[model samples]
Target chain A: MRLKCPLCGDRDAREFHYRGAAKLMERPEAGAGEAAFYDYVYLRENPVGANSELWFHELGCRAWLCVSRDVSSHEILSVELADAVKRGQA
Target chain B: MVDLTGLSALEGLLPYEVDGAVLSAVSYGAITSIMPFRGQKTAVNVRLKADGGAALPRIGRVSGPVAKRLIWAGRGQYLLLDLRRGAAFDTTPDPAFDELAALSDQTSAWVVMRLEGARAQEVLARLCPLDLRAGVFKRGHVARTELAHMAVILWRRPKGFEIMVVRSVAQVAMRRLSGAMDSVAAQAVLGEIS
Candidate 1:
């Protein structure tokens, strides 16, 4: 498989590290409660179809990316910089 | 104090000339990494333009004055290469824009090398995974990737290319580059015989 890095262009999957769901970036607010913190720390959903994920271009541009991909077919619909996504600019 | 004047990462095994390319260590006056402070990119760009007469380069690009090249290292980062001042360039942040950006010396952190020749592309193709065709990776293009498991920055120059790798792994990079050159040379010889 190949992942197209926004900065480095298309690169082999070997150059990237799959960092799991992009939802992980949304941490709960400080002092939000134990349940919220627990969910944030350990809960994950195994979605069957389309999913948003976080990936690190460890050997390429070294940038974190948010990739919208299909779980069943492994087709990537879009890729954006994780930082931009965090800043609401993507 | 220890006498450490003539030390180099390659230990004198540089300026190697092969059938298709010449590998030589680059002696730069100064090398620094510049990173714009959070939300200060615009200010940093203005400062860089005032200082170097050019804006920060986009990803996979390079800019700056002729002798002092600014290469985009990654997100929000650039590597400034001042060739004319080899090892003597000041690395401290210019007081005029110290609040806009962060500057760090990288001269000793990296080992710079240049590969140039008519067949330089062929030699590089053996080790690099990037698409380096003239139309694709044009002059002034930069790429941060791995060559033989060693992280490296590849910059396409007008005549050939420049490669920078961390000093800790410079020996491995040198060996791998030499091996790639030899492999390409061997292929050429076999093609002629066939």
Candidate 2:
């Protein structure tokens, strides 16, 4: 598998590390119930189809990437710099 | 003061010449890492242009005066090298850029080497996985990749290429680069024989 880095272009997958889901998790506010905190920490939706994930280009640009991919088919739909995505510029 | 003249990482292995390339250590006046503050990319570029005669290089590129080169070193970072003198870090903080960026001396942290010759690209191809064809990786292009399992920064020059690696792995890098050079040289000789 290969990932097209926005800065470095397409590179082998060995240069990147697979981080987990890319969805932003909301932390419970102070005094929020334990159940809410527990769910935030432990619960994750196991989507088998298209999923947004985070990856670290450890050996390439050293940028965090948000990768939209198909979990079952391993098809990468898109890759964007995580910082740009968070800033709404991607 | 301690005698530090012979303490360079490539003290003994440099000035190595092989069949198609020459490997030599690069002496720089200063090497600094510049990281722009949040939302200060334009400010940082202006400051760098005033100081180095060029703006900060874009990703996968290098730019600057002949004496000083600014190499893109990953997201929000650049490695500025002054090659005219061999002094240590001596740049006074520019107040104009103080709020726009941060500068850190990286002179002793990295060891730089230059590989140049007609067949230098072939030697590099033996170790690095990047597509280094002349058209693909032309002069002024930069890439951060692994060479022999060690992280390295590579930039193309008009005559050849420059490689920068952390000081801790300088010996290993040199060995691997020399090995690749030897391998390519042998292949060229075999091709002629057959």
Candidate 3:
């Protein structure tokens, strides 16, 4: 599979390291309690259809990307730099 | 105080040649990495223009003259390669734009190799997965990719290709590239025979 990096254009998936779900984008506050922290750290949704993921462009731009893909078909729907996503720019 | 002398990582194993390719070490004096601070790209470009007579290069492009080339390494990152032998840039960030950009010396971190020949593309195709067909990856293009599991920065030149690998993996890089060169040359020989 190939991913189109926002800055480096399209690249082979082998150059990227899959970093799991993009839910890490949202973190519970320090005072949000034990269960909140537990859910944030360990509870993962077994997403089946449209899924958002985090991938590191290990060999290319070294940018963290938030990828929205169809889990069942492996079709990539969108790719954005994690920085931009975190900044609400993308 | 202990005295130290700098030696090339591939001090004796390079300048290798075969029927179709030549692999040799490049003594790139100093490589400086320039990373613009967030929202300071324009300011950094202004400084770069005033300093090097060239602006920051676009993604996958190279700018400036052969002596002091600026290569786009990744998003907001540029590598300044001082090609003049014995010339070195300050490892510390220049005070001119200390806040606009972050500068770091990469001379000791990377080892460069030049591969040029009639079959240079074939030799590289055996290891790198990039599309190297003529006109596709034209001159002045740069890409960060892998060659034989080792991360490498590849730059396309008018005559051939320049590969930059980490210093620690220099030997493995040479071994793999030379092996590819031998394989390509052997394939050509067999073709000629048949």
Q: TM-score of each candidate?
A: 0.91, 0.90, 0.94
Residue-level error in angstroms, candidate 1, position B183 = 0.7
lDDT per residue as tens, model 1, A1-90 = 888888888897778889898888898889899999899888888888889999998887789999999999999889999998999942
**Tens digits of per-residue lDDT for model 3, B6-64:** 78999988899999799999887789899999989999888878875588888998989
Q: Candidate 2: which docking quality band?
A: medium
Off by over 4 Å in 1: B1-3, B86-88, B192-194
> Between 2 and 3, whose DockQ is larger?
2
Clashing pairs in 3: none
lDDT of 2: 0.85
User: lDDT tens string, model 2, B87-112?
Assistant: 55465545676788888878778999
Ranking by TM-score: 3, 1, 2
State the C-alpha lDDT per candidate.
Answer: 0.84, 0.85, 0.88
Backbone clash tally for model 1?
Answer: 4
Question: Candidates ranked by lDDT, best first?
Answer: 3, 2, 1
For candidate 1, lDDT tens digit of each residue in B13-129? 998887878888887666888888998989988887777557889888999765788999877789888776534556665677688888888877899889888778888877877
Interface RMSD of 1: 1.0
**Clash number for each model:** 4, 0, 0
